[model samples]
Target chain A: MVRWEPGAEGRLQAAALNLYAERGFEQTTTADIAQSVGLTERTFFRYFADKREVLFAGQEHFEQVFLDGVAAAPAGASALDVVASALEAASAYFPDERRQHSRVRYAVISANPGLQERELLKMATLADAMARALQERGVDEAHAVLAAETGTTVFTVSYRRWMAEGEERSLAAVQADTLADLRALVLAAG
Target chain B: MVRWEPGAEGRLQAAALNLYAERGFEQTTTADIAQSVGLTERTFFRYFADKREVLFAGQEHFEQVFLDGVAAAPAGASALDVVASALEAASAYFPDERRQHSRVRYAVISANPGLQERELLKMATLADAMARALQERGVDEAHAVLAAETGTTVFTVSYRRWMAEGEERSLAAVQADTLADLRALVLAAG
Candidate 1:
């Protein structure tokens, strides 16, 4: 139910991403994207409020993945482990076939400061949601906040590595490696 | 020089804070803040870009403390230790005298969602600065990123505790406790 289905919304998003990447986000307009998909600007507006929404369309489902993972953790799991499970769950959202799309999306975002801020806001929202979920699971508030933030940091580092040139590992594997590195750093605190 | 010196800027900021708290951030205006300080609105603009600037006026020097601490870290310190040094450095920025000012400022920001986003952005920027400083110190990329983010999380949790009603711990003390808890969580990960 989450993938870009062969629907008007999907077609508009695909076209918008392609145009935004090729022509640059600033240089592309909603009409250009809609026209590329053989649709009118009105149709594009019907599906997306504007151009940026195309880049953020999956955010709700993506956040739900993290919340669901946090809720599913065992009662006795450590905060870090609970967060790791959430990070692992997010990997399913990014399959091997979607890597190119992700890479392009990352590029588009990197090229725009506004998009970058929006991306950071989205991550902050995810952290807040994960912390609340953990709290609901009977985790203490401070621990939940710390672990949820740590989860976002791991996801950020892993996401960058996944998008790095010539990187072949899956997002889950990269996230695991990053999580391990974080634990090692924490354990090695002098 | 940073401790709200007895000058027009300091008076304006203090007055703005008090008025924002009493009247609410949305209800207070620049003219009201200026008039409270017996200054003109034009004079107030000479000191702050806008009302929000009053809340963030100390951010630059605050960030400098982190960068300085990171730069001055002993060559062999662990990444977490380096981050701890930075966190300790920042504590001086929030002495007991400024605690009430901070509490009021926090309330004002908390009352407005936009201001909260700005605060998060400021924290994210601090993390980026600390990460770069760590990398410059030859710490590995992953470790630097993770430690810097962990440092911000410690700061956030500790600051909240510091601002909590009936809480009396120094910011640095709270930070140490939070850091220790995080390390414990990381060590206990399974």
Candidate 2:
């Protein structure tokens, strides 16, 4: 017989998200989150460094997915194409079931400057990681950084559209539209 | 008899930047900045909303230059072209004499997460203004936004490159290279 141990981290995160959505991020406490998840406050602290860390727990996973996607891009692709393909792969990792909660969390984070800064830092770190991955794929440093920045820009636009529209379209579609828009903008400028 | 008036805001910003560069953003205080400018603390407050505002006082002027340049772009020019033209015009606004101080200020701001967030907000606002200007010139809203974002991306890349090499190249040349790189990335991707 297999034993079913408590998924303390997942439960704490789910509880924190719910509480944050119901009340607010600033209003919620680690104790409240711990109690809701039926875990001790100590256990909660053991899982997350702080209450805010619960909201950002998936950042590491996001980085890994993006890096792996970039690594797997075709060898002949240009830096931009490689990045776009990686973003497409990363998009598949975000599901519709989680979109509502993600939007709510984003709203909470956006309303707070500190949280917004943390989010930006996280995104910047991700951009750096993508650039490094591109460099490993044989792209030069400057072009690799530009490619990563371009990918981040497209992701930002697509995510904004997705969140604003309640995730009605697939993430891939939104990303594709963003890439096309980028191309058209450049060609028009020329 | 004649009366003399001082540019209080400019003096305060200069003082603040000097302190920030010599010491650091975290080590500097409003009082030190005020004293260095030969003004009372109250006078500094009257000129700026806070210490951070001193560093950002000129952002509006930059935005205006960019918008004006975009508006004056030749007819039938693409959105990217308009944005590139705006960046070129804006580049002329940055004084050669202030390059060293500007570099120091940039380093301080980049090193501080709080300042970085504020900087991002400012850039986002400028991009929004650029998009609005483009829309006023008959471009569609979505396309205008994409164009503005692309332009900002190029400007950022060019500015970073210029800073990276200690301002050896003219801002105009760097801006041109950035636009060319962006266009090439997009075309290669397509």
Candidate 3:
């Protein structure tokens, strides 16, 4: 696979975002993104299948980070505890520096219903992956699914908060707080 | 808007299911469905937007039933209670008689990635609607989101179980059991 020259990926991503935001997503083409980034269209395609994928390219790594966390959770942790550890592990994928890129990506996605639906499907996929990872660790099917789904929910709420225009907290901090809130709400049902 | 005859809707749905099962969702056309039910293509168009919409048409009512429950929850109930109440209300929409229909629909959806993604987005939409309904009842935004998201997760888990092959429990009964399970799991964290 052709990799980006050092720091070139960021330049290409920035150019694509500017173009996608300036011109409508439908009207933009790979050539436009490539030209704007001073890279060949062949180079752009080498990195992403299409212009639309520019927004989704990081999803695999994001999920892998969460799955790694799940796989690395301490043995004997409760299902929810394992999920929490995984969530915290995934948070490192979104550092303080990456927030603006996410905010812009969220903006681009929010404006299009198809993109928003894709975003929802993407989160669901992450939950399924996490559940599978949990099950591999000997968690029962139901417990794995429940823990993963709820963990994904907490992460989504926190990620959205973290991506909010004025919110400044790290995804890890926001997610930690959200998980506690979910626990309190669930415990309240007892 | 044109309406189906007293039994026409059921007949159409049954015929569509048979065709979709035999020919697959992608190969099945709206005309094929209408013809199978001995209705004109015009009648088919009147009831559903497309072949795919036949599987999705009931979603609007499903979300509405849950929202009504949220709206009518006993005054001053806790946020989680309100969500649970809404979930129970929605259960009435899925009686034992509807089980086979759901089973077939779920099969059709699971076999198609596009349909599966749409299903995920639909569930996400339900959660958002539930959250908005909770907020209207004076629950704080954060509490409303956490409760609604978790409630939707529970409902999804229970619904999948209800639709599983050879599963005989009513959606309501299964949901109640699942809700209790979720409560136990959450409480275990304390």
Candidate 4:
């Protein structure tokens, strides 16, 4: 029995991150998060399945950004090009405004193996979504899956580089560079 | 305290897998594994940190195989080629004799998100180990990591294909074919 509360979701998420950062993920509980947000436990449950869910609220939205990008890519684009375009579209989801929060989120995830596993599962699920999106665009099943996985790898490497100290380039710029590096590596492999 | 009983480790692993197969991983317990092996719970703990660890007993040995192959690759080999060679060496770890076990192991892993997370962590660790091994062999840090990761992708795709019903190709052969497919896909992308 949960009721809608305007702005409650964002407030709860911010509170959860703060508590997780302050007390570590394992030490943080649902009640603590709800209390910090001035909300009830039932209200928290309305927005998130659990504490971990708060950290991953954007997984589905990010997946949609990626898939929409693939669908809107120029016809006849190479498979990698389509994936790259999808990445480009998805990059907007992590603008400079969110950089500090992203860093804190990444830090919390890295500090907890449970969170890291959840991150892995999210990435794996996104890869599958990307693959299916590619298949919808007429690519073969095997090639679609590979390209999607490779695209996820590209996103991961670029995200790390983008988060590194003194990094000033946009996420899109870093992604383009890493994609080129991957291309060159693959080419040289043959 | 743990005792060094000859054949105890193998017996425990076999028993754990059997139990996991018969009564799902979630339903199976460490005590059940020990009881089936005619050993005390203390002995099971001595062999495995937990029930999930039993499914991952070969992770370290597999990592060693990859690292050893990287160390032995020719000095002039390209980064991807070096990783391919490592995969070739590691292929021996999953010969036909182990196919049934591997299939059962993968099944148990697929059934549990917790196990899937552990599997992802193990794979990530192995990739890092492979990357470090390549760096030691004179490959640049960036190229080493990318090559190692790509090789892991190749291994994963090939292993899945090999495990499919009626697949008769050897692990090494499937790996060779998959590597070639990746090369072609990347070449086409560029």
TM-score, predicted candidate 2 vs. hidden true structure: 0.87
- lDDT of residue A5 for candidate 2: 37
**What are the runs in model 3 whose C-alpha is more than 4 Å off?**
A1-12, A38-44, B1-11, B40-43
CA lDDT, every model vs. true structure: 0.85, 0.81, 0.84, 0.85
- Can you write out model 2's per-residue Cα lDDT over A1-190, one digit (the tens) per residue? 4334378788888899889888988999999998886767888878789987887897888988888788787888899988987898888887667678778889888777667767777877788899899998899987888889889878877777777754598778888988988876776555
CAPRI docking class of candidate 2: medium
- Per-residue lDDT over A75-124 for candidate 1, one digit per residue giving the tens place of the 0 to 100 score: 88888888988988888888778888889999998898667767877888
lDDT of 3 by residue, A75-176 (tens): 888888888888889889889898997888788887876778778878888999998998999989878888888888888888888988888888999988
Instruction: Report how far off residue A118 is in candidate 2 (Å).
Output: 3.1
Clashing pairs in 2: A188-B78, A189-B81
All candidates' chain B TM-scores are: 0.93, 0.92, 0.90, 0.95
Please give, for residues B1-190, the per-residue lDDT of candidate 4 as tens digits.
5468899999999998899989999898899999987899998888789988888887878899988888777888888888988888888888998898888888888889899888888877888898898888888876777778778877877887778778889999998887777777767764
Residue A14 C-alpha lDDT in model 1: 88
**Candidate with best TM-score:** 4
Model 3: per-residue Cα lDDT over B12-65, one tens digit each = 788888888888999988888988878888988777887777777778888999
What tens digits encode model 1's per-residue C-alpha lDDT throughout B72-127?
A: 77899999899999989889888877788788899898888668767877898899
Candidate 2 or 4, higher DockQ?
4
Q: List model 4 lDDT by residue over A112-136, tens digit each.
A: 9889988988888888899998888
For each candidate, report its DockQ versus the true two-chain complex.
0.61, 0.50, 0.61, 0.58
- True-structure lDDT of candidate 2: 0.81
